[model samples]
Each structure stands twice: as C-alpha cells, then as structure tokens.
Target: MTALDSFAPAWQIAEAVKSGTVRAEDVTRDALDRIKSLNPKVNAFTDVTAERALTEARRVDAERDAGKKLGPLAGAPIAAKNLFDIAGVTTRAGSKINRDLPAAAEDAELLKRLHAAGAVLLGALNMGEYAYDFTGENAHDGACRNPHDTTRMAGGSSSGSGSAVAAGLAPLTLGSDTNGSIRVPSSFCGVFGLKPTYGRLTRHGTFPFCDSLDHLGPLARSVRDLALSYDVMQGPDPRDHACADRPADPTFETLTDGVAGIKIARLGGFFSTDGMPEAASAVQSVAKALDTTGTVEVEGVEAGRAAAFIITNCESARLHLPNLKTRPDDFDPDTRDRFLAGALLPASWYIRALQVRHWYRENFAKLFQDVDVLLAPATPFPAPLIGQRTIEIRGEEILTRPNIGLFTQPISAIGLPVCTVPVFNSGMPIAVQVISAPWREDLCLRVAAHLESEGIVAAQPPSHL
Candidate 1:
C-alpha cells in the first residue's frame, strides 16, 4: 500500500502527531502533494491552499510542543465544500453570479468548529452551481468525475467533496445536503456520507441555497471518521434558528456493539419498484447479512417526492430570483431554464408541500415504531455515464441520472437523519440509504457497522495505488 493507503484516521493522526512519530508538517506536506497529483484529473478542487496549510500545520506543531491542548481533530487535514466561508474567500455556492462576490469576513461557524478541532483546511472544493442540481455536471467549472470510474458522474451538489475523498485528496470533506447532495455523492463515489437531522449542525456562514431546507454535512471514507466529524460539529448555534439544543449523538466509537437484534426492513414499493437491479442486489446483501427478511412496503413515496420538488423549486427560485432576473446569463445553462421556471411556482404549492411534508413525517414516525431502520436504494441506478441521460431499469426506460434521487429528496425535505452506505457491487458503485428517526444518527451508523462487519460495505479499490 502507498503512504496514503496506510493513512491513519484523523483521530489516529492526532495521536501520531502527539507522540512525535509523525509531524503535522510532514502529513500536511504529503497531503498537498497528493492533491496536486490527483486533483487535476478529477477537478475535485477549485483551489489548493498549500501555503496556508503548511503554515497552519507548523503552528499546530509548535502549539503541541508548548503544551497547548490539542482538540480531537487537531492536525488533521480537511476540505470544505465551496459554500462554507473561509476568511478572504468568496462564498460561491458554485455559481458564476457570485464570482464577483467579496470574501467573507469570518470563518463559517462550522468551519470554525472544525478549525477549533484542529483540522487543517486544505482548500475550498467545487460543487454544483448554487447547489441547484444533483447530477454534478457543472457548466462553468467542469464536471466532477467519479474516482471509481472517471467517465461516470459523481453525484452532487457536494460533487467536489465526494471526488476529493474518493481520490484521496482529503480524508474528510464537508458537503451540504439541501436535498440529496451529501448522500448521493457518497453513494456514487463509494464513500460514507451523513445528512444529519435538521438543525443538528450550524448553517451560519455556509451559503444557503434554500433558507428553509439547506443542510451541511460531512463525507468521509469510513463510517467512524464521518461520525467523529459529526459529533464535533453538532451543538446549538443561536445564530441559526433551526439549530437545535439536542444532546450529542452516540459517538461511532461504540458502533462495534453491532446491529444484532436491531429490527430492520427493506423498503418496497417506491424504493424497490422501477430502479436498477444492481441497486436492489446491493441492499439485499446487507439484508441477508443482517438476517433481515423480505422487503416491507412504503406507500406515498411518489406524492412525497412530488411534495419535495414543490418545496425545493419554490424556495430555490425565491433565493436566486434576483440573480435569475438580472443576471440570467450568469447561471449554468444546464440548470438556468429550470431556475427561471421555478420563479413561477405559486406560494400555495409551497405551503401545501410543507403540509404534505408534515403528514409524511408522521407516517415515517409511525413506521419507525415498528422498525429500527428503513433501507432504500440511494439511487435508481449506479452513477450514470457522464452526460448520459436515458437509463434502462428492469425494462422500462427512464431519465436515469437526474431523477435518481427522486426518493432521496423527500426524506431530506422532512429533514430525516440519513446515512448512505456503499454496497459492494461489481458495476459502477451502488448503495442503500439507511434512515433513522430524527436525531437518531447513532442507529444509522450502528446499522452501517453491522453491514460493514458482514463485508457488505463499499468494495474497496484493489490495492493498486
């Protein structure tokens, strides 16, 4: 294995730094080298803050020697989705309209926590323009390619975060999930992603695509690393009204307890019907490994997904109306027309969608009363070929790539805590969404650990790097 493959987790890296076996400067230097060599091919990063990373590493190393308390993630390297503000950096939510926007005055709150935890910010990663789409095809900043297969798409708007982690550009990356941004990319790129429950983390300083439904989250290679980041980033931020005062999540440190006796179900109906067969097989392996029985039915998914669309399009239109109206030419042509159209959705639809969201949440709540977790396909198909639209599912033809998350958006619309686990399949990567009740990320990770122990987790690249 290469130096990168044998790379330690963030926590272990901190311990190594503390023990003097590995210097923070050395690790940061190696990380910068890796990004330089790998990121160009992937277009995973918009900028590379090498000078700053090295300076920060030297500072942390000095503080450690002076007996300063090192936070849990100290000296660990991380990448932030471009939407998060880093001092003097433009907070572009991946749009040209914001190209002329001035740099932020302060670090985004989430970035602040990560900095406080001692994580070195490598640079800002690329993403879907204004986070308005899911396919990861950016007109201005080239497409973010899937590392597993360069020609296939890396699901977005967290496109850069997914590609960066998959390509070993960074160990942990922050991504926003207004809908399926975080989970989709994690699934497609064969990484672990968590979309925390609504208000679980601060959105302050993170550019919001939609004021009501936006979410910021982490994407990492391992479940433990992802969970560790989540634990540190969560807490009440009076600055964000949606921010919650909830207690901490059970650290993934305890995930080894396993999912034995954990009641789980494979969602049928909307989840099972009309999607890629490989996707079903991937989830089936996890079910069989966990001794889960046949799929359970989930009704009203179409209605739920429709409601989610209404809410997303309406809110997004309002957020960008000024840009869409004055600088229409500035938007990515791929999503510009859709943005213009969204400007016309009636307020009645948006409000009714919220009502539908409430009803769906209640239904999900009742379903959880019987099952510990619900399992559903993360995408209708494996990451589709770059720019390829039509997909064959079972037998019927469908617009495979963009609508792959038809099922995911609804879950996010209600702000459910979700963890997308990569399923080891032979073709392009596939995964299953394991969703737990609100604020129950612990349950989601425990279930993921069970699948991991059974060898049903992401299929690692052969040791060829």
Candidate 2:
C-alpha cells in the first residue's frame, strides 16, 4: 500500500478517519507497510504490531459504522518506547536482560487510555538501555539513526520515539523522560515533544528508570496532538504511587488561548549558550519570533543539574542491583559501567541529592511567580555523529552522553512541565524548551503553539527521508 501522507499531522489523520473520508484499517496498513519499508533505514521500531494494529483499526471502523462516538484521537497511529508494557510484548526497556522477562499481561495505563481514545498501537520503539542514555546508540539493538541525517544520532533514551515520528512511521509516540530523553530526541530529530510535570502522568505499567525523576509523555508533529494525548492519558492511577490524585484537567479545549498577555522570560545564567552556537542561534531566533527581550537568571541551575545526576545514578543503580550482580556481562557495557559506579556511591550522596531537589523546586516556584513561561535551549547542540564520544564546548572536551542534558536537567529535576519546540536554523535541527510552572503544561504548549504559528518552529519533513 502506498503510505498515508506520512507528513500529515495527527489531527488531520484523525479527522479524516472520524469523518469516514478514510478507513482506519487502511491507515493502519499504510503505517505498518511504511514501518516495514523505512524502519531499516531509521531503526526506530523494535517490534511491529501488524496484527494487533489491524484488529484495533477494524474495531474503530466497526464502532463508526455502529454510530458510536469515537474519542479525540480517532484512528491515529501511536507507539511507545519499549519500556512501556504492551500486553503480550516483552517490556524490553532497551536492555538485553529484559528480553528474558515474561511478556506483559496488560497494556500500560497510558496505552490503555490511548486505545480508548481510538489510537492504534503501531508497535514499540528502541531506546537507550534502561533509559540511561542521551544518544540513541543502543549496544544491543544498534543505533536509532536521525531521520534528517542517517549518520547522526537520534537522541535518547527515547531515541526510536523521535525517529519514528520524524520518519513518518507514526504520528505520535509515548516516551519517558528521566533527564532529557524526550526533549533531546525532539531537538535532534526536529519534532515536538513534551515532558509533562513529573507525576502528572502515571508510571504504573512502564519500566522504572529513575523512580523519583522519571516522567512519561508524548512526542508529536504538532502541539495540539501533544495536548490531545496529554488530556486523555491523565488522571490518578492506584498502581503508580507517584501518580497524582488530581482531576483530568483538559488542555486541548483551552489550547487556542494565545500567549499575548502571558509573561515570558528567557532563562539566562547557567542556561547561557557560551559554547553552542547552534543552540544559541535557535534560542535567539525564537526570542525574536516571540518578540521578547527580557532575560532572567535562574540561581542554582548548575547545582540542580548536579543533584539530578546523583539522584538518577543512585536510584537506577539500586533498581538494577540484582541484575548488575548476576548478568552484568549481558548488559550494555556503557550502561553497565555507569550502573556499577552508581552502585558504589555513598548513601549520603543520594540523600544530599534529594535535599537539593527540594531546594531547586522551591527556587523554580518563586521564579514562576514572576513569569508564566521560561525559554531555554533543550540540548546543548544538535544531534552529534553516531559513535562520537566527545563534543567541544568552551574549548573543553566533554563526554557527549551526560552533557546533552545540561540545559534540560535542572528544569526536569524540579518536576516542572516542559515542551521542547524544534527550531531549524542550520543543517541539523535544534530546539528550545518552553517551560511552565508545575501543573501548567497548558502554558508550555500555548507558547509552543504561538511559536509554531509565527513559523519560527516546525517538525518539517527531513529532506533525506
């Protein structure tokens, strides 16, 4: 089958399916066929749920024929990072060790919600093992290459999530952000991604990475799709202790509320683009488009990033201690080495990290009181060449893996909502983070939508693809 206009936005696809202008099954088949054809080039999908997707699509058609009302995301194809449980599929979590685990008995809570909202499950996407990576190179599954330039990284641990959407295999995908997984991939692959406020989304059926810092969200081609996915997959879940017992506050309905009067500020100080010309240009372009000149210094941002690192290392190390003890050789060498180091860290470091988290959250709370939204670079630079270990910043060479999250970690550490908007300024695309106060994801998306409206940012199809 010829591919569905893979470049078409999710909202358009859903509207067509809902109006009977197209059949859901055909859309599913087109997506599956596209995955079969393009996935080898991109290496995005680890598993393709052809049979399951067709079945779901047919059900959607049947419901339409029966005059049953469909949900907001009617007939759009969606996939998740392999970490999310998908019923019979093994929750790989991008690790060789997880391949031996039994298949999940039920779909993840978010997936279930998507299913209810008429999203067909396309399959699972690749990621950095155990969600510990910034680059998309997975030792077990090979790298998920950037769609724009196959030679570059796709950004990860949500690597495949970003690649699939950019490559047009799927319109929307679910990914978890422990540090900058969603935002990094969004920046690198030139797509829109949201790392909703931590705990705003449930982690019940997804694999645990950094228990305290982990957050689940969607990456899409359009800001509205992000709002649609966010609206549906919310609400408290008993299975996840961190899931907030809050009402489902819908953002899609209120999305068109423009950012005219909203106070916006560019984050300065630690977020300055001292070494990354591409990142700096992207931010400046966005500031020009938004017509904002005001800048504010965020105190303790560097320290907050440090706390995020310590907390992530300790929590992930403890979670995988049993496997690290037994199947260390089976694990990816890079991930194993970090896990081992985390295992040896003193307990006091983790405690101090938690204390820092509280302090940082308080600091951001005060900052938000002055501005409704904050702007900053999502990643230090664009996608680096795959297998490139070090990047030059400020005339100093630093490891690429850890430093990619330099701008993102501090905001994520405080569990604030963020939407990374892709800005195409040079050969490769970079992005700017639109951050809002806790529980104010609506503000993040609103600012992102405004930028998109002004033609400053977009998820344009890659020329190479």
Question: Clashes in model 2: which pairs?
Answer: none
TM-score for each candidate, following the candidate numbering: 0.95, 0.98
Looking at candidate 2, what is the lDDT of residue 130?
Answer: 95
Who wins the lDDT comparison?
Answer: 2
Question: What TM value does model 1 have?
Answer: 0.95
Q: After superposing candidate 1, which stretches have Cα over 4 Å from the reference?
A: 1-7, 273-275, 462-465
| Count of clashing residue pairs in every prediction | 0, 0
lDDT of 1: 0.81
C-alpha local distance difference test of each model:
0.81, 0.91
Candidate 2's displacement at residue 85, Å, is 0.3
Give each prediction's root-mean-square deviation over alpha carbons: 2.0, 1.1
* Best candidate according to TM-score: 2
